[model samples]
Target: MKKILLNLVHPDINQSVVNKRLLDGIKDLENITINNLYQKYPDFKIDAKVEQKLLEENDIILFQFPMYWFSSPALLKEWFDVVLEAGFAYGGSYKLADKSFAVAVSCGGSKEAFSETGKEKKIVEEFLYPFEITANYVKMNYRKPYITYDAEAGLSEETLNLYVKEYVKYIKEL
Candidate 1:
């Protein structure tokens, strides 16, 4: 079985529906670590060594978060700065090479809003290039992100359940 570090980075997961359910749906899965960043480091003091060690031990690194201002939550970026250092994630003797990297991001707008005829005038993939670049930089395999559009007001209980199942499947397959 593949070991996944499902790093969650939501400002307030209690107020979240999609991200929280997504996390809960996978609790019983074997070899999956649910690392809630905000809960762990509310004061923004990241333990780089421990985070790096988690990365080293996992077969896949899955970033789960709500898209914030076209990027990840602050702590995820902060975690990146602190943990993905030389001789570990990149630079000489990098360690993340060949592992699978993926993201499950929730967007506030509907799918149409990101379409060419929609408000943003761009696809969801456009906002995820940074993750792709980071994955590529570390020589890890980058997969297409699993996006949940209109996350705040979107989906019924049935739809959310389906999405959660899909998310679980996505991680297991990776």
Candidate 2:
């Protein structure tokens, strides 16, 4: 199995419902390293060398977070800026080349709300284009994103349970 680096980038995961449940379901699985960014870097001071080392060790990099205003949380952006600097992830070496990069995002709105006819008037995939392009630029295989809609609004117990199972299965497959 490919080793997975699960980067959980929620700003306040302790208070999260959907993201918390998803993490709980997959936390104990083998070959999966869970790195909670907010917990690790509370002051937002990320260790680029350590993060680059983790990237080198893992075959698959999966970013798990709740959607914040159609994009990832602030730290994740900062992580990219600091860790994926010149001579490492790009510019020449391309350390992350050929690795698999994917996202598992929890959205506050419903699926319809992210569509053309919906309130947002744009598809969720459109908003996720930057990730795909980033993966391509770094020469990583960009997989289709996994999304859980209506995450903030909430889901029934049974539905949440099902999503947890599905999330675990997805990670295991990767």
Candidate 3:
């Protein structure tokens, strides 16, 4: 079976209600490697070589995080900056080329709040453009994001369960 890497990059998981539940639902499945970035790099010191090795091994990569200030947590950004080196993830060499990348994110606000027709003044797709651009640069297939909205309010067990099922389905398809 092909390997899928799920990088959980939540900074404050202790305070996280949504992401914690989602991750708990799938932490034990076979063929999936869940790398909790914050726990691994507590001092923000990411091992570039190790990250590169993980990327090389996995056929599909999922960046799972809680949306903070419309972006990834500080540590994930640092990981990208340090690990996605020139002549590796990008440039001509393109180590991640032909691999699949997807973002599974939880937003504190409601779905309506992330729309031009609503308060936040941008679509969820627009908010996720940075990830898409990065995936494009690395020549990876940028799958549509799996987003859970109103995350701060906490999800009902039914809703969380549904999302977890969908998440597993999404990974299987990739």
Candidate 4:
């Protein structure tokens, strides 16, 4: 099986229902390295070299987080700025080419909110264009994102359980 790198980056996990449950479900899985970014770098000071090393060691990279204001938290953005440096992740002497990247995210709004008939009236894919562009820049295969909607409203126990199972399946398949 291919090694998978699961990068969990939630700024406020204590208040996150969907993400916390998802993490709890897969915390003990094998052949998967779960890097809790906030826990590892509470001071907001990331180790670029170590992060780069981790990126190089894994075959599939998963960025797991709750969608905040249509994007990721500040630290995750910082991680990209610092770790995915020039001549490494993109630009001259790029190294991330041919790698795989995917996003596992949860949104507070329902799926309808991301469609023409809903509030935002725009697809989530359109909102996540930047991530797709980044993956393209690094020449990585950007897989379809795995999303859980209306997370704040709370899901049925059965539905939540299914979400966890599907999440694991998504990561494994990638």
By TM-score, how accurate is candidate 2?
Answer: 0.97
Q: What is the lDDT, from 0 to 100, of the residue 45 in candidate 4?
A: 94
Question: Which candidate ranks first by TM-score, i.e. highest?
Answer: 2
TM-score of each: 0.96, 0.97, 0.95, 0.95
C-alpha local distance difference test of each model? 0.90, 0.93, 0.89, 0.88
Instruction: Mark the regions of model 2 whose C-alpha exceeds 4 Å error after superposition.
Output: none
Ranked by lDDT, top first? 2, 1, 3, 4
**lDDT by residue (tens digit), candidate 4, 41-152:** 9898999999989998988889999889999888899999999998788778667788889899998899999898899988888888899999998888899999999898
Return the clash pairs for model 3, or none. none
Clash count of each predicted structure: 0, 0, 0, 0
TM for candidate 1 is 0.96
Show model 3 residue runs off by greater than 4 Å.
Answer: none
User: Which pairs of residues have clashing backbones in candidate 4?
Assistant: none
Residue 10 accuracy (lDDT) in model 4: 95
Give the candidate number with the greatest lDDT. Answer: 2
Those runs of model 4 whose alpha carbons end farther than 4 Å from true positions after fitting are none
User: What lDDT tens digits, residue by residue, belong to model 2 across residues 1-174?
Assistant: 889999999999889999999999999999999999999999999999999999999999999999898999999999999999989989989999999999999999999999999999998888999999999999999998888999867699998999899998888777
Off by over 4 Å in 1: none
lDDT of 1 by residue, 1-174 (tens): 879988999999998999988888988899999899999999999999999999999988999999999889999989989999888888896799999999999999999998989999988899999999989998999988989887868579998999899988887788
Model 3 lDDT at residue 127: 83
Q: Tell me how far candidate 2 lies from the true structure as C-alpha RMSD in angstroms.
A: 0.8
lDDT (Cα, 0-100) at 80 in candidate 2: 91
